[model samples]
Target chain A: MPCPYLEYRDTSADQSFDEARAFCTVVEEFVQPMRADICNDRYALDHESHCEIYRAHAEGEE
Target chain B: MSYEAFLDGDPVIVTAALTGGVHGKEANPNVPETPEEIGRAAGEVEAAGASVVHLHARRPNGERSFDTERFQEIDDAVRRHTDDVVIQHSTGGTGAPDADRHRPLRTDPPPEMASLDMGPLNRYDHLTSENTRGLVDSLHAEMVDRGIKPELEVFNDGHRNEVHGLLARRDLADPVYATLIFGPGTLTRPRPEHFLTAIADLPDGATFNTLGFGRHQLPFATMGILFGGHVRVGLEDNVYYERGELAESNAQLVERVVRVAEELGRPVATTDEAREILGL
Candidate 1:
């Protein structure tokens, strides 16, 4: 599943991935697809999550 | 990627090439010539949304210098003013001894990145930047030793082919980053189709940065964002804010590009994101 905080607007003429730039709410920063690709969208998985901020946020909730 | 499975594109990484060696205050008085000036400009550009600062050291008299000490001083000044912007040094030059080209990478804490010209290109009627295969290999080897990522400078299609040649001979770090430059002289022609062709020609998994000289800067930068690649701006590539007026500051140029990216629905990459994208 895509990260919950990953917000994007796809407006490409053909609706391709060309125009989709993602932003992460947890860190309040724009992120590359590489980071967004593996994020769990819910609770962060300790070894699998590429985002430190999302992991910390999930830990705080727990 | 085809939308059978769609994937988000990378955020735009805005790089500010603060001051170029070819021109100085004479071209634009706002071009920073001293360590303090460059540092202050670095901070401003970072605030305006650039995640990387491309640096060129200058002598006290405003001439370009490849001295390691000068690079060190500039790096020190940059750190004093900004928090996390990546620092990239320019190693491409004309008429300099082949050995002196290595000076920029020898600073105490060498730049996190350095430009590596893929091949030779003509500068003026009488001069040529002889970035022969041997020099290119030597520079790439040093960057590898220092853990500095080489931002391959692709001036034309020949240089693009050289990128393939370099990759065939030696292994570069993952996600090979190259800057596709457009302009007169030895640079690729400034046209949308040419830029698209360059993008199409890039080896798989390599990320490209868009740079257009002078009047081509803004339009190409917008296209870069639309195409989901990074961008570079500032007085180094352009001295004007518009056709006739000189740019007030490097920050102004960065600010304009940031605005364009936002309007196009693309978020600007933060410094951390830039590091992640570039593997720096």
Candidate 2:
């Protein structure tokens, strides 16, 4: 998702419009699918964290 | 144990927001402010078939608060008065900024659930409210640590996409509980197509609720029941009971929701059933 915070903050004139355009162009060129594939890894981490919390609560109840 | 079973039972989970943070005593003489008054109002709504009470604590002088002591008093008072109704606190207390909106959860830990506003919203059409990425991550961490469920509040399609992002990133859990807020001059206008479009974006195993601001509350709530989503109603989001008359109490709003649900042949879900449905 586009970061509204960044959008609100980057309106400064110090960074020229040409510079910002060039930065975006460079980022798009360098982007790779490997970073996008990390979504599954993040999902696994979240699942483990949830299970740990549930296990702790179960133990406390016991 | 599944939400599908609860839906099959035809019971809607009615959440009564007893003390809304926006309105004050001047708008309606019955807007509960003190902890004792809020607890008392919640008790009545529970008796009137509301399974959950969404609370917003106020200072003694009627200002909103995320103070631990104030929230504790309300939580304790509500527990004293009712056993069946689930107590859910709002993280978006008055005067709270994006950085500190989840202070209630941090200080008081968590109740049964806490509100998780999904994304940046142009609330009231006057403010460009931003819930920063860092704030969302921290709030999700707190909820995870405390084992408290989050009631995701989505105000627009962009908000829905934020929820999807959280789910995709695994920041949100299964059977996410969402509430679609509809109002005029907002992202989604108060209408059936808006509701359908919002529902269409929901992921699998997700359950949703609906609330409409102002005069649209009744019609939107009726549509919510027919479409198998829960309903929220109270004077905080609205003042008048009808075209001109003011609402007498929060219980009156709760009663209206119940009547609409019953008229649609949907029974009200109990607190336990609601927990299962929302995966709390």
TM-score of 2: 0.76
- Per candidate, native contacts kept equal 0.00, 0.00
TM-score of chain A of 1: 0.56
| CAPRI docking class of candidate 2 | incorrect
**What digit string (tens of lDDT, one per residue) describes model 2 on residues B1-280?**
1234335656798988887665556456687777888888888898888988888876554545667678888888887788768878887632255544665675454687888777676533223446665777778788888887888888777888888888877567777888999986545777788788888788876788888887888888887787778888887677778988989998998988898788767888888888887777
Candidate 1 lDDT tens digits, B1-280: 1111112544789999999777766567688878999999999999999999999987764556788999999999999999989999999766567788999999988899999998888753434678999999999999999999999999999988999999999999988999999999889999999998998898888888999999999999988888878899999999999999999999999999999988877788999999998998
True contacts kept of 1: 0.00
Interface DockQ per candidate: 0.01, 0.01
Clashing pairs in 1: A3-A41
Query: Ignoring the other chain, what TM-score does chain B have in each prediction?
Result: 0.97, 0.92
